[model samples]
Target: MGAMAAAYGPLLPYLMRRFAIGVSVAGLVFGVHFAGGLLGVTASMLSLGRLTSRVAVSGALGLMAIGCIGVALALSWLVMLAGVFLIGIGFGALDLRINQMLAYSVNPKRVALLNGLNGVFGIGAVAAPILVSIAGARYGLIYAGGAAVAAVALLGFRGVPGRLRGASSSGTAPSSRRTARLVVIFATAFGLYVGVEIGVAGWMPTHLHSAGFGLAAAATLTSGFWLALAAGRFLVAPLTLRVSDSAIVLGGTAVAVLCLAGALIAPFAPVAYIATGLAIAPVFPTGVAWLATLNPANPGATSWLFPASMVGGALIPSAIGLVIARVGAGWVPTILAAVAIGTLAAFAAAARS
Candidate 1:
């Protein structure tokens, strides 16, 4: 879903021309996508008692497959908006549900495993845009390919319900005031983490173009970001076993801040963007791990992160666009630097709270 929705970043300019939409409208489109996601995750959590995990996962994946094909083939602006919104719902639901499941099963060693799984998203982020680039047509066969993959995945959906059932028996979430306070604090951190991550991915191409880079070069840099992100998740996994989650998150965010500083100040932007990806890779997965520690058993404990993240993804990039319009895209790095710092500070506050 990250890839499917984010592929639009590099393609946004072309999409703007094809769909005859302005940057503000385009930003609104992106916002709508996240809003759909917020709805999907919320509905999933609220209806958990009525809907089996198997049915929910299957339906969500199916929607994703359909949505991707729809977006790729959409002929009008409204159709594209619908497709994007559908993709958002699918992405949001699966992301929240799957991660919630992982949180339910958390242990020291398992935290590393969770990071590794998230790394896989980086791989998809890299590939999805490239597939669009490779197809080269306004509407291409690659979108349908996503649907086919989802169809095949449905065969394996049967086991999810069993796992969810097992999760219910193994742990107990906190009900105290401490848990409520921690949840509120961590939700803020999670939102910022998601905002920075999605904002960078969604707007990098546009920012690079403003800095005078060509389309191909910009797309390559964007892919490099995801590549580094995917690589970092695995490379850092071994360290998670030894390092405290707080230290790892702090270290990662601090290095990410430095990378954003480089991106802001450097003559060339790709190097900094790539380094930023690698440095910031640990934040989300480590956050998931940390959040589980606060309230290990309740999936809803972690559900709040999804809504927070969705709101962040929706608002921050749009805010960046509005700022870029006033200040120029050269300020992209500076803007991102502040966001990176904010994330670092948010995590520190969460640690204390």
Candidate 2:
């Protein structure tokens, strides 16, 4: 899922060339993809009451496999969009279900485990560009490969159980109020954090290219950002033995804000962006774990977070694009810094209350 999701950006130029389309038409890929993701998340949330984990997870994987096949066979750009939309649905549902399952699990090592799981996603994300480079104009092979993996992964879910131990629970009014507040704060925090993460990733290459770096160099630095994220997710799991999840999120976001601030300097921009990814790597998984702990009575507490993240992924970067059009690409780091600051503030508020 992560590989296919991340593949889109690196694969965009090929997509455009393959269909003989301009940037204006090609850009709709993101919108179509994310729109499918939002609907997928909603569908997953709605299915909480009716669907088993095995059924939901399996079905999502099936959709992803079919979507990839669709993209692999598509001859037109619109068909490719449709394929990506299908992939987004599967991606969104599988993402939510897996995290939800892990967060609500009873394992003592679950925090580290969750971080590790998300780190694997980072690994997939980091691998995507390389895969794109290898596949070149035949990028459909990458999607076809992803489809094979997704299909094979279905066998792993046979023992996931129809329901989890803590999958469902009831809450009282006071706890409900607290849960609602935490949800809003964390959801907002996640939205902003995802926005910043995706924003930096989506714009940094362009920003660096505009600043005079060669296209290849800019792309390499962008890959560094993803590598840092993957590395951080793996490395931070050890810290969970000594530190609390909330503290980790707070510290990570704070450092990310500082890193983005440093990125405003042209020479330091690449290092700063990479550092920002490293700092924020553990925030998403750690925050989800922390929220589950806080609202143990409601297993569905983390469901809303998925939608918030999707919205942020779509909205924040688009907002940054508007500012970039008016001003320039140089403001990319500045805008990301502002978003990181907002993320830090949101996490801080959540931590306090």
- Worst ten in a row by lDDT for model 2: 166-175
Kindly report which residue pairs in candidate 1 clash with one another.
none
Cα lDDT tens digits for candidate 1, 19-72: 787766676666777887888887676655456678889889988888878877
Top lDDT model: 2
Best by TM-score: 1
How many Å off is the CA of 271 in candidate 2? 1.5
lDDT of 2 by residue, 163-227 (tens): 65555423212247778888889999999998888788777766887788765566667777888
Show pairs that collide, candidate 2: none
Q: At residue 274, give the lDDT of candidate 1.
A: 86
Q: CA RMSD for every model?
A: 2.5, 2.4
